[model samples]
Target: MDTGFFAPLLTGYEWQLSLYAAVGIAAVTLIGKYLVLLIPAFRAEHARNAAMRRSKMTKPHYAQNQRWNRRWGPVFLIAIFVGVLPFCLTAGSQPWWQMLLDIAAILLVYDFFYYLVHRFLFHDGGLLGGPLMWVHAVHHRQHNPCRQDSSYIHPIEVALGLGLYAGTIFGLSRVLGDFHVVTVVLTWVAFSQINLHNHDLWETDRFPFRYLATMSRMHHNHHARFTGGNFATITLLYDWLFGTLDHGHGYGKTKVAIRARSDASGIKKPPAEAGG
Candidate 1:
């Protein structure tokens, strides 16, 4: 895991060039994501959902919090950019095929780590109370999140989550040698698209990349109904491995069933429903 290879590659203007390329790649990836929304079916679906959200807006505090979160969007982006800057400058010495493999490994590791932190740390109310719980509660306020809500999160939660991602990448680089700048950029681009798409209301199951729909459904379930399961961000591998994969019916169709089960068990209704 000698990272010496990156020393020569990143010297002089090479690191700056790599950073510029990463920014270009990221911009293209974002444009592609917006293009997906231009699809007729997706456009109509988003419009309908937006209307519904407006009609059902009963919580003034939720709107206020979202506005507050929106103000911090630039801060979150800066954190992500700064966190990934180092990885973007390093260049791997491996061949193209090997570099691809290493990139896959990094993404897999990231998803696995994210699943653990999200499930055990972020979502675990018993372990994290007071301000921490309140931070997570803000994100959960949007039962069915739209594009705007995708990045709406408490700053503390953002720092913790991004810190874990950066730490994982940096730690892996030490053990696996310098990862290629291309690999790092591509991985981040894919992650950004997948994360945003998952938060959106679009159903992508019928798309050519079937897995996009699967991941989206899993994340949607986490937000809509089964909050305890489906914790993985880009893939369900960790969730399946951990036996937390909940492929039950969609939230809309299963609300009655969930309510019935809660009532039968003598458990109180969820805060979302209770407040609604």
Candidate 2:
């Protein structure tokens, strides 16, 4: 409790305020991201994407999608992070040191289940039929996802995804006693922000092994050409442990597939990107 500079001052309502604050921060950052289209580079991307659309080269970046998602994303973000979420965190119940444990525990626990859902339900989980995978297919339509594409998910998938997060917090509160409000809010912010970063157009292969940038591309690849592995977000521990940590080598033919993807798409995969 009262971990942040102003959290101590809020007292009884700290958890609720933290929830609202998290929503505000996420909302502002996301809206600001949309404004990046005004930038010259991103504006050029808009033009290229328009051409791609004219030629029907891609369907993931539809104008209707951005319109709807921009309007609805914040609403759902608020609903999940603020409205549906309860003020369940206890007041000064856990020590400050436990906050770290709370963050790690929630992330690990959540990512474990996320890995399962992402691999099994989202990617068919090797079930051959993958009936439920269609709910996730809307997201995978983009091999090279843009930042706006992060929230551009089918509503059903959004429910399942956000539900898992909310369910984790509720479960942790019930099983482990209410966690610190600031901890949960901060964790959510990190989760949301990183989830967006995962969809960015950054070329991370230039970075060293296990670097944050590399890890972001690892997630990007999960949504892109290598839809099978890298199921975990925030950490690769689950992917690595479960043998699903696909970063090119984690899945398919290396040089051949790389060249094929390059040749087919005309977007050359940097040499370092071949194996990520």
Candidate 3:
């Protein structure tokens, strides 16, 4: 394939091209993540699971959180689009093969740095005071998060997280001097899809993308009882390298650990495993 085969497609209208790409990414991600719900068997299974989970709930359940996520999700997506726009417009000129390589490197770097930011800065309450903690707390509220919950984050969290990510990518582009915009856009889409898949409540046992099942499982554990570990959103490389990868006690079953904050005491409990 010619390196510049698609160059003309994005030659003049960089911002508009980026916007269109973002829209396409959103469309594909939504359809891919929730497409399983269209399958009769999978839909029935999800329904049964939802029913069983609701039956044992002591508080408002999935539907409530899902609705809340849906309400605020578009705002979060717009924030992401704004955050990514600069990088997309400033993408460097590079050969297609080299651009692909750069994209892979950027993704790996983003994953590592994000794991650090997520675990130490966002989740570790001792490091920062009230406001920052509150940002991440919104995400943890829905332990059994649905697809919409993927982007259902506080604006502060979105600003910090995506800001850091975009800043890093731009910095790397400047240093390398040939990081293409197409690479950045592709990586952004992948990043968004992976986060969505991680938060999706659907079982992935028979999914065509079986390789991503590990990520799905690790993220589930992160939401379940092993919140302290498995902080990486896209890949387990950082978590595994740092010894924070907790696969949990059970493989197939959900660990019933609720992260609750006590209003009066201002202290939180360690995730306690609930009996199955």
TM-score of each: 0.71, 0.68, 0.64
Scanning candidate 2 in windows of ten residues, the lowest lDDT window is 267-276
Q: Write down the lDDT of every candidate, Cα atoms only.
A: 0.65, 0.66, 0.62
Off by over 4 Å in 2: 1-61, 81-84, 204-210, 250-276
Total clashing residue pairs per candidate? 0, 0, 0
Off by over 4 Å in 1: 1-18, 34-67, 76-84, 91-94, 125-131, 204-210, 225-227, 249-276
For candidate 1, give the lDDT: 0.65
lDDT of 2 by residue, 7-57 (tens): 644453344655655766667667765896676655664565445444432
lDDT of 1 by residue, 75-191 (tens): 766654554555534553668897788778878998988877777676652344333556767677666676555656776777776676667666787788766677767777777
Tell me each candidate's RMSD, in Å, in order. Answer: 6.3, 8.5, 9.1
Please, what are the lDDT tens digits per residue for candidate 3 over residues 208-228? Answer: 646655666667667664244
Off by over 4 Å in 3: 1-84, 87-93, 125-131, 206-209, 249-276
